[model samples]
Target: MAVNRACHLIEELGCGTVLNGMLDYYPTKEEVQKVTVNPQRINKLLGVNVPMDQFINILERLEFKCNLISSDKLELEVPSFRLDITEDADILEEIARIYGYENIPAADLEGNATAGVKTENQKFMDKVKENSIACGLNEILTYSFVSPRGVDKINLPENDEKRNFVKIMNPLGEETSVMRTTLIPNMLNVLATNVSHKVEEAYAFECGNTFTPQNGLPVETKKYCIGMYGKEVDFFSLKGIVETILNNVGLKGYEIESETTNSTFHPGRCAKVVYNNICVGTFGELHPDVIENYNLGQRVYVAEINADLVFENITLVKRYSALPKYPSTSRDIALIVKDEVFVKQIEDIIKANASDILESYKLFDVYKGSQIEEGHKSIAYSITYRSAEKTLTDEDVAKVHDKILSELSEKLNANLRSN
Candidate 1:
């Protein structure tokens, strides 16, 4: 629904929390170092001035040694039991709590309160979820941190970039020991679980983040994925799902071509989604080895989209135009090309030669049988012609139609289907 730059951000005014703070923590075993405390800073922060003597007395009663090194500063030795008092802010909060928080009269909050609203990127993802749900996919969420074994499970190569994992120094367990570079493993795990539970079929999607290790930091990239395993699932059905999302996002001049090299997917069944010559996604049925690795009994299909790429390229502004007033004419043509010829190749020829009056064309049928020659196939299309200035006569439409057929014959060696 919208385009967003960078990751979603919150411009908090007075928070001291660092975004890239360390996750690893090691508690001291022997003793905590003495905290450098300032009574004036405590008072300024808490907005209540208490005399230094009173501060020292209150801490002493709590079994703390407040050795005054300056008029306003003290080298405070915390009680052995107060192991949490390792930082000055911790000691300040303790003083406030002991001084009775109810006694400090509350003042009006500073500045204006910012009303929470969804970011444009957040709204776009929400739209993706809704549209996917309408297409009959159940929304599912999986953990960002997953086992390192996932890379192996998918049979990624040794030099694959996904093998560069952001390992957790203190993970929950071995299963959650590394940040995910791809959602394929998680999706496979989900589909595998459903089969284990004896579910007949599953169609699920996730719009989430994938972490890529970049220059010793985990860079968050948004990803959208769909996984399905059922008697109803097939390559073309999954392709339809992909096309629906692409059109819904308003992309143009995109290409879907065959892919064969990815180890995770079945060769010849996989295809990449490219827009403006940039590959934004890959989708296909699982390789037989992958199916065995996941212990899945049924064939599975998966699709992954670099949603960050889509977010960057999507155009939210839609133009409007009135319906055509003049009558439109239609033409049905069937042509035969070699077995190796792609539908897009024929379409390219038609589009290149068609005149301005050619409004649209749709593939109505494709035939391969005894009536057709071996090592070739027959394809049919219903072409429409119209004019903005006036209704197109049969003679006018025929000239353009003949021109397109001539080009197809010349460029692709296509023959008209007589049967």
Candidate 2:
């Protein structure tokens, strides 16, 4: 609109004179010439018969019009004929631009901000954090990138995703060139940092994603990792922490069988936390060699929980019982069982034979010594029985005892020793 108006105003005037040349009032000589030549070229390019004399006078008149337009639009008339604004349409568009976005009405949205509840995956992460914290673990944050060479220090899965790292095109340094595949490396780095700073007794946890390449595509997996460093940190400490975490996350009544699964941890001191027959996580003492490689302050208790598996469809159903009103009998029975037998199997057998009056049974002693035969060990279990109905005669107790012995002998092939 402004370009057509300028051309019309110039056509009204009759003189072939360059109207404006002062640097302050207009542009440099070359810039003024470029702007002045535009109308003439437009006439030639479009084959419009625009007289130079008339266009010159029209430009002179436009100086006043330009002042009025500039004042009305609150625009600064700079002197440069910038290449960006070489086209008349560009100049005209700028002069006609308006700021009225506020005049537009907003469209209604379907869901409000209150609908932002955590998704299933987020809920899993929340449970992991909550349970870990409840087990005396402090949440921690660390950078996802680490030194590529540092990965060789970790004893992870042989065909681990860590072997394939995402390298940065432009990194701060080699130390931060590759994205970490597991939280353990970054966690160990943090521990080393604290150790260097003379701080000890650290218990930290992180819930984050690890990157892997699956069939030539980048795959990110989220895991919840925990590390504990202190003089007292050991496999049992990590076990207790994992148990507490699982319980808090509605994973009560689950089991952790002592089993060797990873090289980063002590083989004999490790166990997998299982819920609903699925392995949710692991607990163990960090391998002494790994500790030395990372230069950690002390032996560390470590556990990693896969948040996804922690929240199985298991329910936290619980029942309560009143205190015993009658006298309770406590008896310890030590039996020899084959190494192939699991304690849970023994417990199942005990529960099967014992009456409902059986209050509790616990395995307190296990032995494979000179006094015991090879490949067989003594498993000492404490059994407590109390009758909810009555404190009957010795005959009733003896009857149940005999039944327990018979069941053990028939099922577990056990010998009952009365000494």
Candidate number achieving the greatest lDDT relative to the actual structure: 1
lDDT of 1: 0.87
- Tell me the TM-score of each prediction against the true structure: 0.70, 0.57
lDDT digits (tens) for residues 40-128 of candidate 1: 88898898987888888888998888799887778988888887788889988878988889977798889999879999888889888
What residue runs in model 2 are displaced by over 4 Å at the alpha carbon? 1-114, 215-217, 252-254, 275-278, 312-419
Q: Pick the candidate with the highest TM-score.
A: 1
Clashing pairs in 2: 9-58, 10-58, 13-54, 15-53
- TM-score of the candidate numbered 2? 0.57
lDDT for each candidate structure: 0.87, 0.68
lDDT of 2 by residue, 1-419 (tens): 67556655776785334355333553545534233124434443333444544433444433412222221222223344344545455433332232122423355555755666898667767777877777788899888778876667767765765678877779999999987777777888778888888886888999887777557656777777888788777665776677666666666667778767688777777788777688777778877888888888477777777665555544456668788788988778888877766677778787887878788997787777877778877888888888999985677767777788778878888764332
RMSD of 1: 16.2
Positional deviation of 187 in candidate 1, in angstroms?
0.7
